[model samples]
Target: MRRHRRAKIVATVGPASNTPEMLKRLFLAGVDTFRLNFSHGTHEDHAKVHAAIRALEAEMGRPIGILQDLQGPKIRVGTIRDGKITVAAGESIRFVLSGADGDKTAIPLPHPEIFAAVMPGHNLLIDDGRVRVAVTGLGDDYIDAKVVIGGTISNRKGVNLPDTVLELSPLTAKDRVDLAFGLELGVDWVAMSFVQKPADLLEARGLIGDRAGLMSKIEKPAALDRIDDIIRLSDSVMVARGDLGVEIPHEEVPGRQKELVRACRLAVKPVIVATQMLDSMVNAPTPTRAEASDVATAIYDGADAVMLSAESASGAFPVEAVEMMDRIIRSTEQHKLYRSIIDASDPGEEQTAPHAVAAAAADLAEVIHASTIVAYTSSGTTAARIARRRPAVPILAITPHAAVSRRLSLLWGAHSVLSADIHTYEEMVERALGFAKEEGFAKPNDQMVVVAGIPFAKAGTTNNLRVVQVEG
Candidate 1:
């Protein structure tokens, strides 16, 4: 089934929507990608879900994307003597690097990396900034800080150091195991979290290679300074506004989100605006008006996709959330100002032969009012290049590799299908026309623009273009 809209929906699969029947319903409701969060589930839990998705994909005859989201290094407080302890504002608290239970006088923070990197003026956000403290003194094993905000500090609550960059890899011991397991399962995308700098992507890349698209999650404030480099190194990017929202000032989240989305578009890579898009839908069947606007805002900003976290993962109404997000995307794309905004935000143009060809194809399709623009891709590059132009016509991305087709599920304006590689130019035209009519992108008399590489089954050879008629 072809989706009427161009922007795709990514929904996290969790306890609320993991059943085979429910998964089918969610897919039919318009979920392009399913994120398997490794942070909360066991290996066994994820494998079953992965198998279910593959089975559904085979049954539905669509390439569905599976994203394995790794939980990076999490710095948390040690156990508390009582279940929780409350600290007052302006109170001096010493955080000792010990695993022992903590008391009011000294809070035990077991992570040495935090102690090593934190400076005297750095702010430490605990339990999601409910308890805020600024470092006033430091030692080899202790950090003395004045609590800026007073709240209860519970055992093992997460710690966020916004000002300090820890000398730690994004992949922890648990993440390594999870990565191997997800790779073995043949995941389509691996979303690495806690990415501080561009170098954070290198280690994950070494392990991932070309198996799956490596998507770096922008959750740290430091990543904002070198976003262009990070986008270049990454296969895709995700504006994970959860931890990101907590680490930076709340007022700056919106600007950062827009900045990250624009940077990804400039780099010609897919970007997903994630976290709290439909939060109220977690318990209700419908989303709040503000949440609806949030999803629309991302679409207006030309983000490739918008995501659902707890709304679809553990929410009471999972399918409803997906349908709401689907409706919002379709409505926003149909807005009168939507195209103008996207056209104005177009990253000028890339200076390359392939990009030139793609741009020419896009302009030709708009000029001739073609029904569809077909791109014969092997690595999905040809389709991505063309889709980046945001052509008025729908894109039919024909690829032989199932992996490539699945990954294209995240790109903007791409409706991908799997087919055998075509060797002859004439054969390519014949197959494209047949697909256009069969996929409902065109009628018998409608014209379609075809863009394909000269060397068949090769990547980065997107130079050929043709205008062809669909035969009955």
Candidate 2:
């Protein structure tokens, strides 16, 4: 099932959509990629879901990408005596480093890194900002804080220190285990959370090697400070606006999201605008007008993909949410304004031979009114570059490597198909035309613009462009 829309949909798999029937429905509903959230499910649970996805892919003969989202260094308060407590504003509280039960006066915060890194005057947000506290004093084993906006504080509630960049690795022990499991499962992308600098990516790369594409989740304010370096090192970026909104001012999130999206585009790294995109759809049969507009806005901004978290994972209407997202993207792309906006934000100046050739193919497709732009790629980079052009025609990316075919699934306007590697120019054209016809992207006598590298099976050598007339 080919989607005419450029922007793709990423659906999370959870209890609500764990069954094979629901998984197939989501794939048919227009989910280009499946996100396996490591924070929630167990390894066994995720393995089952991964197996289901692969089964569906084999049944349908369509490449599907799997993104493993690592749960990085999530800080939270430890156990409380009564399980919860209600603190009034203007009250004082103590966060003890010792892992012990707490009363109204104090709570255990087992994460020593936070206590060691936090200083007086730094803000600590609890329970997703439901309760706010300002550090009044720091001790060797505890932090004295004054409640600024207090509410019910419960056991294991998340703690966010927006004012301080704790000296910590992005990966937790659980994340390392999860990463190894995901890599073993052969996931296409691994999204690292709370990445503060480019060095974080290097650490992940050292572990991941080339097993999967490393996608940096840009949430921390420190990450935004060194956005360029992070984008350069990472294979992709996800604008995780949930923690981001909590860390930065809510009003600044939209601008920051745009900046990150544009930066990733300039770097030619795929960017996913994620978190709360259709949060209302988690329960409601339909999304709010604002929710729909938020998705459309991301597509208009030339984002490669928009993601659904709870909306698809544990929502009452998973298929409906995916359909709504698909509708929103299609509607936005059909707007005359979208094309102009995408053109205006074009990443000018081709930096490599492959980039120049991809641009030429896009132009050729437009001039000839070709049915599709066929890209023969080994590592999927050539297809990605062509998709970045936001060409009016669909991009049919043929690859020999299953991983490459699956990874290209997330790229905008890319329709990936697995085929044997082509050796000669004639073989390339023959396979391209045959697959385009078989895939219903074109008919006999239709024209296509094909792009690829010269040396067969060579990666990152996409320097050839040709316009071919499909044989009758």
Candidate 3:
């Protein structure tokens, strides 16, 4: 189905939206991509969901994207005495590298990376920053800290070290296993979590190869420090605000999100604004007004996609949440000021052959008020460049590779359809007109801007641009 909006919606599958029936409903409601979060659910369960999504894709005759999200190196507090402990502000807490339960004086941390990495004056945020502590002393086995924000500390509460960079791989044993299974399942994208550096993506890229798009989750301050490099190494980026908010000051999250989205746009990569976009919908049938505005703000910032985490995975209103988000995006895009905002934040032109062609195509289409911009891409690179321009008209990207078509579903303004490889300029023009008409992007006498690589199918070459007109 054609979406009314440009930005894509990625919904995670879980208890609430696990059934094939529910999955179909979500697709109809506006989900362009399905995210299989490895943090929860068994491999078997995810396999079933993957199968269901493929079945739905076949029945619907639309290329759907699947993102395999790997849970990376999550550090949480170990079990506490009596299942919980209360430490007052300014209280001294000594964290030991043990697996046993403990009281306030000697809480078990059980993570050597933290002990090895954290230094004096580093801040440790626990339970999503509900309780905070500043490192005062560190020994080989213990981390002594003064409580800065005190609250009840429970067993396995997640810990966030905002001021320290832990020396650890983004992938763990569980993630490797999940990545293998997901690659075998033919997922379109693999999202790595807890990415702290550009080098962190090298391992994932080596493992993933060209099988799927590698996306780095931007939730760590260290990631922000090297975001351009991370974005350069990865195919896409995700603003994982839930964890990001805890790691950085809450006020900085929005600014960071805007900068990340704009940076990705400038780099011509898809960026997803994720986590709690419609958080209130998990319990309520509708979202809070602020949540709706949040989704719109991401769209205004030019994000390629926005994701639904718990809202769709375990919420009471999964379909409703998708519908609401879809409506929000459409409404925001149609807002009179939306185009102006997108134009104002435009990163300008990249001085290269492919980018020049894409920009010329966008410029020509707008000048003539064309019905659509048809990009004949084999590697999907040309289409992505066009999408980065935020063209006023819809982008009908025709690709010979179904995988490329599916992956393009995440790009803003791209409506990809798999077709046989075009052999000549005559064939290219004919197919562009045919597909544009068939997809309802144009009618007889309508104008279209077409672009492609000259040698074709060789990839990364976007040299040709043409203005084609529909004929009766």
Candidate 4:
């Protein structure tokens, strides 16, 4: 069942949502992407979810994008004595960051990388910002923190010391193992969490190579600090709102979300707005007015996707949340100014050549009232770029790789098809038009626009643009 909505819905799969029935319902509810959060599920469990989604896709005859989210290096304070402790402001509480063996007065920090990088007076937020502390001293194996804005500290609470630039790789050993599994399982996109710099994305790409597309989850404040570089390195980006809302001041989230989405658009890269979009719907069948508006805002901001975390993963109304999100997206998109904003975005020089060309094709297609925009891509960059434009017409992206096809299925306004490799531009155009016809996206004599790169422009070089009409 093809959904009429343009903004994609990403439903995170968990115990409540792993069933085939639930997966099908969510798909029918307009979930364009499924995110497998490695933070919660085991490989065996994820395998089952993966199988269920694939089966559902075949049964429905529609493509569903699968994203494997690697639980990046999560820094947390070690266990507290009695499993809980409370510290008052200006108290002399110390986070004895030696190892995971401290009591309530102090907690061990297991991440040596954090210990080495932390400097005195830096802010340290624990348990998703429940407790705030300032670093006071550092030792070879231990760093001490003074309670600055003390609050209740519980067992195994997440710690976010953003001021400290830890000398650590984004991928942990578990993440590396998960990356291999995700590749073998044929996941469309690998979402690397808490990505701080371009090197983090490059490393992930090195691991996945061309096996799947790399999507950087921009949640960390450090990532926002280096947004341009990270966007340049990543194939796509997700604005993970959970930790972002926790780490940064709540008032800043709205502006930040808009900025990130606009940045992604100007760069012609696909971007998703994620996390707790419909938190109230985790229990209620319908979302609160605020939640509905939140989802609508993301769509209005030109996000390629809006994601449901706990709402679709472990909520009482998993499928209903997806359905509600879909309804809101479709309704808001009716009078939405998405096409105008997308059309107005000037593809900057900062973007890659292929990205710029794809944007140009989308712009021209919108102006010409083309039936469809056909993209022949190897790395799928051109296809993703066109999708980012969010033109009124559908984007048919034909690629030589199944991985690329699966990944592009998640983007806004894009439908991916796997085709045999084309060695030349003529072969590329013929294959694209043929697939478009077979898919019933275009008819004979229908006009369309095509974007590609010049010879030797590399796999993702999409500097060439051509407009043609299909012939009988």
Candidate 5:
């Protein structure tokens, strides 16, 4: 069965809602995707969750996407010697970086790369910006910063440096191991955190090697700077607004989110708007009015998905959050503007063979007022190309591989059908059209546009297109 809504809900898995029974309830509540955060859980723990989800999939007889999120290069303060440091506002407190067992300073600077790259006048936010520090001077072994705004600093508080780029690789050692585990586990998607360049995506994709699609999280300022390149390199993109908001001006995040979503759509890659969506529902049963509007905006902005963080993972209301998200997705999609945005992507020029074939299929569907558009894709690429056009009719993507079927579950307007291998382009189209007709998804008189590739065309390469009428 195909999902009716477009804005898919991605619920995070956490300690509060990790049981198999709870996961099943979440699936029933309309969660299209499950986000397994690699930062918190052990590999064994994730393995258990993976098993449980697969069991649910077997029972329900439907595909559910699993996204593995890697913790990429997280910078935090070292241990505080006194365990706590209370500084009043306007009080000048010194932040010292020393190898002295972290016992002398109010907050020990653990990341030496941050100190080396930091210059005077740069601002450092600690504990989620509750405390602010301004670099005043650079020392031989340590960097000194004066507390411009001080608050009580605790152990291992989060540090945010907006101005300076730390000389660090996007993937940490832990991320590499986690990615390997995800590949072995056969997850549907892998989300790389703090991706700053296309090279980061290339490295991850090389490791993944088509086992799972790479999703770049736009959370760093450097990432925002190179978003076009990142979008081109990655299979999908996510607007990770949490750390992104901290890194950039708060007022600019909303615009950035829209821009990023549009860019991904033009590139024909699915984009997810994530972080703090339905966050207030973590404790409260009902979301704030503003939060509801935020979700609607994401849908209106043409995002393929909207994600939930603590709302479904550790919140008091996990199932309720999913249900609410489902309702909002359906409701927002009813708007006339929603379809406009979906159809607003940059259409490919009918020049290249693949582009010409994809465009012709879309055009034929529109000309014949077809009820269904069937695109036979081996790698789910040609189907995605057609989906980027956002034709008004439904897209039926037939593939032989089960992995490709599951991955297409996250793409917009694509209903994937797993079928036996067809040797020729005509056989692929006939199989797809026959399936659509046999399932009563389309009537006898319904028309459809069929797309495949020429002789010996590899998967993901489409060089043929045809318009066919379903025989009675």
Candidate 6:
């Protein structure tokens, strides 16, 4: 089934939508891709979900991408003696580097990295900022802090240090194991969380190799300083605004999100704006007006996809949330403002043959009023370049690689399909024409702008563009 809107939706699979029947409903509801959150479920649970998704893909005859979001280094306070505690503002507390339970006077901050990285005056936000503490003194194994803002500090609550840049790998030990399992499961993408630098991508890439696409989760302030390098190194990026909003000022998130989306567009990398797009839909059947506007704003900013976390994973109304998001996107795209913004954002001069060819195909499609811009790609790069142009017509990406086809599903305006490798130019055109017609993207006598490389099956070699008419 084709969506009327260009932007895609990524729905997370969880207890609320893990059943095969529910998964199918979500797919039909307009979910372009499924996110397997490694942070929550067990390996067996995720494997089951993965198997169900593939089964659905086979039954529907469509390419659906699965993203394994690795749980990076998440630091949290250790257990408390009474399961929770309330510290009064202006009270002093000690964070000892131990794993044992503690009383009101102190608590265990078991992560050595955080203890090592933190310094005097650094603020520690606990339990999602409900409790705050400013470090007054630091030692090799403990921190003496004064409570700036106090509330209930529960057992093993999450800890966020906005000022400290811990010297840690983006992938935790659990993440490495999860990555191995996901790769074995044949997931299309691996989203590395809390990526602080470009080098964080290298280690994951080394492990991933060519097995899966690597996506950086941009959530840290340090990541913003190296956004370009991170985007260049990774296959794609996810603007993870959850931790980002916590680490940085909440007001700065919108501007940072716009910058990241625009940068990814310029670089032709698929970018997903994630975290709480339809958060309220997690409980309520309908989304708030502010939430609808938020999703629309992302589409207007040219994001490739907007993601739903708890809304689709563990929400009370998973299908409704997807349908609501779909409606918002379609309605937003119909507005003249959306089109004008997309048209105005130019990706500068073309640098490669594929870039020029993709640009020419988009231009030709608009000029000739073609039914579609069909791209023959092996690595999905050509299709991405065409998508970056924000063409008026839909993009039909025909690929021989199943992974490439699935990955392209996350791209804006890209409708991906897998086929056998074509060896000749005539075969390429014929395949494009056949799929365009069979998929109901075009009819006989309809014009199509096709782009591909001269040497078939070789990746990143898109250097040709042709205007072809479907033969009657």
| Residue-pair clashes per candidate | 0, 0, 0, 0, 0, 0
Task: Name the regions of candidate 2 deviating beyond 4 angstroms.
Answer: none
Candidate 1 lDDT trough over 10 residues, lowest sum: 97-106
How do the residues 389-418 of candidate 4 rate in per-residue lDDT, one tens digit apiece?
677888887777766666776677777777
* Model 6, C-alpha of 147: deviation from truth (Å): 2.3
- Displacement of the residue 81 alpha carbon in candidate 5, Å: 3.9
Give the Cα lDDT of each candidate: 0.93, 0.91, 0.93, 0.81, 0.81, 0.92
Q: Residue 325 of candidate 3: its Cα lDDT? A: 95
79: Cα error in model 1, Å: 1.0
**Stronger candidate by TM-score (1 vs 4):** 1
In the range 174-223, model 3's lDDT, one tens digit per residue, is 99999999999999999999999999999999999999999999999999
Candidates sorted on TM-score, descending: 3, 1, 6, 2, 5, 4
Off by over 4 Å in 6: none
lDDT for 419 (candidate 1): 92
User: TM-scores of all models?
Assistant: 0.99, 0.96, 0.99, 0.89, 0.92, 0.97
Q: What RMSD does each model have against the real structure?
A: 0.9, 1.6, 0.8, 3.0, 2.4, 1.5
Which ten residues in a row are the worst by lDDT in model 6? 345-354
Model 2 C-alpha RMSD vs. true structure (Å) is 1.6
Residue 168 of model 6 has an lDDT of 92
Task: Evaluate residue 348 in candidate 6 and report its C-alpha lDDT on the 0 to 100 scale.
Answer: 77
RMSD of 6: 1.5
Candidate 2 per-residue C-alpha lDDT over 7-101 given as tens digits, one digit per residue, 9 for 90 to 100: 98999999899889999999999999999999998999999999999999999888899999999998899899979989989999998888678
Q: Could you give candidate 5's per-residue lDDT for residues 57-96 as a string of tens digits?
A: 8898777889999998877777666676776655555555
Q: What is the lDDT of residue 33 in candidate 2?
A: 96
**TM value for model 2:** 0.96
